[model samples]
Structures are given as structure tokens and as C-alpha cells.
Target: MNKVVCLAALAAALGLSACVSSSIPAPEVTMSKVTRGMSQNEVIARVGPPDRMRGQNGNECYQYALGKYGDVPFAVYFRRAAVVASERASCNLSITRATAGPGIVWQASDYAATRR
Candidate 1:
């Protein structure tokens, strides 16, 4: 009887641990691993098309935004002809249309002069 109780307790603990260990997947954003001077097409290949795109100074710019419940918004900016300039935020939680708000705007020059 003692051995059976111990086994059952161990199984319950293991089950609880398994439940707690499963974590939500991270968000999918364009320009997650972008580099400088990467063409617009390359950025699309990695992160898919942006929610919206704009042109400035003859360069194309893309903006990717993700917002999740109980988490701050995530935004990534890509220059028209360059890789990601900088990540606006660090939130990695999954975002959805229902949770995501307005689109973010990225400027072309901001990424044009970036070294790396």
C-alpha cells in the first residue's frame, strides 16, 4: 500500500509538471532575423508580407506589429532595401488579429544608413 501511494503521488507530480512545462509558441513577425541591405523580397521570404507597406524617398518600408492579451505590443521595422533597423519591443507572445490594434509605420531612411 505504501509503495502504491508513492507511485500515484509521483505520477500526479509528473503530470502537473508536464502541464506546466508546455508553453505557448512565439509570435511570427517579418524581419525577425533581418540584416542590412536585404532586399524587400528577402524580408518577405523570411517573415512573410508585412501587415502594411509604405514608400519614402524612393525606398520601401515595412512594418510588422503583434499584440497579445496581457502583453505589450510588439513592432518590427524594416527599411525598403535594408534589414531590420531595430526591434521596437521584446514581447514574444503570440498575437492575433482580434488582439492586434492599428498598424505600425516604419521609415525608409531609418534603416537605409544602418551599418549592420
Candidate 2:
């Protein structure tokens, strides 16, 4: 009886550990791939709708927020009818809102001129 109880306890411990490990979702931003001139529809299809949208200089900027993980804010810059640049600012949230600063900006030309 003691041996059976020990085996059951071991099984229970292993099961609990597995459940804990699997409960944390993988990071969401790793798969984000954006390019210039991709239409609003294309962006939606690839990354889903932005967490929020705002305007800048007559262009629309889509802000994709990564919740609470100190992940960066992905900003896609669109001008006229095409995407011009993409930027990501490493950010963290304080009590009520997110705080981010200037981040690396990747230009569309850089991505377009590359093959494969």
C-alpha cells in the first residue's frame, strides 16, 4: 500500500509540473513580419488588427501592443497609399498606461531591395 501511494504521489507531481509549464503562452511578437506597401487588409491578414490606430501627418500608423511583457510597440508607418517604415519601441507599462520611446526604424526600401 505504501508503494502504491508513493507511485501515485509521483505521478501527481509530474502531472502538475507539466500543466504549469504548458500554461504560459509563447511570446506573441516573435512571429510579427511587416513590410512596406502592404495594404491595411494585408496587415490585418498577417498580424490581425492593431491594438489601436492613430494618425500622423495625414498618414495612418498602426500600433500593435504587446501586453504587459515589456515587449516593444510595433509601429507601421504608412504614407499616401503605401507603407514607408516600421519601428519597434521597447516599452513597459506603469500603473495606468504604456511608456515607450524612440526605437529602431526599418525602412521599406531596405526590405524591398533584398531578394528572398
Candidate 3:
């Protein structure tokens, strides 16, 4: 009976530890594993679900909140369900064509870049 109680306590402790650790996001090293040509499902599996999603059909964009404060925005562009490009920046930007080098626009105090 004593052995059984001890095992139960140990199991409970490990379960609680797992729950606490999972609440924190994975490190940057995990995010770095993401690469071009990876599928949308693959990216989601690596980084978890995206915080924001935009676009439709062939052109799709998914934004994830990163960094210690969750302030850094990471955008991954998908073309035909495959990753074409990924960008990390202070301003949230979305482009229809991930391969295209579009102009970056800046406004006074507020930075308003191209978001589509």
C-alpha cells in the first residue's frame, strides 16, 4: 500500500511539471528549424498554431507572435500550400507575392508598411 501511494505521488508531480513547461513557448532554435518549401501543416507542427492568418486561395500568410514579450512579429508566406518566404520585423507586413521584392513604405511616427 505504501509503495502504491508513493508511485501515485510521483506520477502526479511529473504530470504537473509537464503542464507548467508546456505553457511556455519553445525556444528560437526550434523556430529556426523552419525552412522554405515546408508545408503549412509542417510549419504549424513546428511552431504551433499561428496567432494571425491572412490571405486566401493560393496566396496565404500566417503571423506568429514571438520573442520574450511576444512583440516580435514573424510572418510566413505560403504559395500553393508551400512556404515561399518568411520575414521577421517590428511592423506587421503581408505581401501577396512572397518572392517579389516590394517597396517598403514608412510614415511619420506611425510605421505603416504594406499589409495584405
Better of 1 and 3 by lDDT: 3
* Cα lDDT listed for each candidate: 0.48, 0.53, 0.67
Please list the Cα RMSD from the true structure of every candidate, rounded to 1 decimal place.
Answer: 12.1, 12.7, 6.6
Q: Model 1, range 6-90, lDDT digits (tens) per residue?
A: 9999999999999989864455333345666666677678766766444433243455554444143334433335544435554
lDDT of 3 by residue, 76-103 (tens): 8877778887777422333634332334
Off by over 4 Å in 1: 1-31, 56-58, 67-80, 89-116
Please identify which of the two predictions, 1 or 3, would achieve the higher TM-score against the true structure.
3
Better of 2 and 3 by TM-score: 3
Model 3 TM-score, all chains together? 0.57
Per-model clash counts, in order, read 1, 0, 0
Candidate 2 deviation (Cα RMSD): 12.7
Give the TM-scores of the predictions, in the order they appear.
0.38, 0.46, 0.57
Scored by TM-score, the top model is 3
| Candidate 1 clashes between residue pairs 3 or more apart in a chain or in different chains | 60-80
Ranking by TM-score: 3, 2, 1
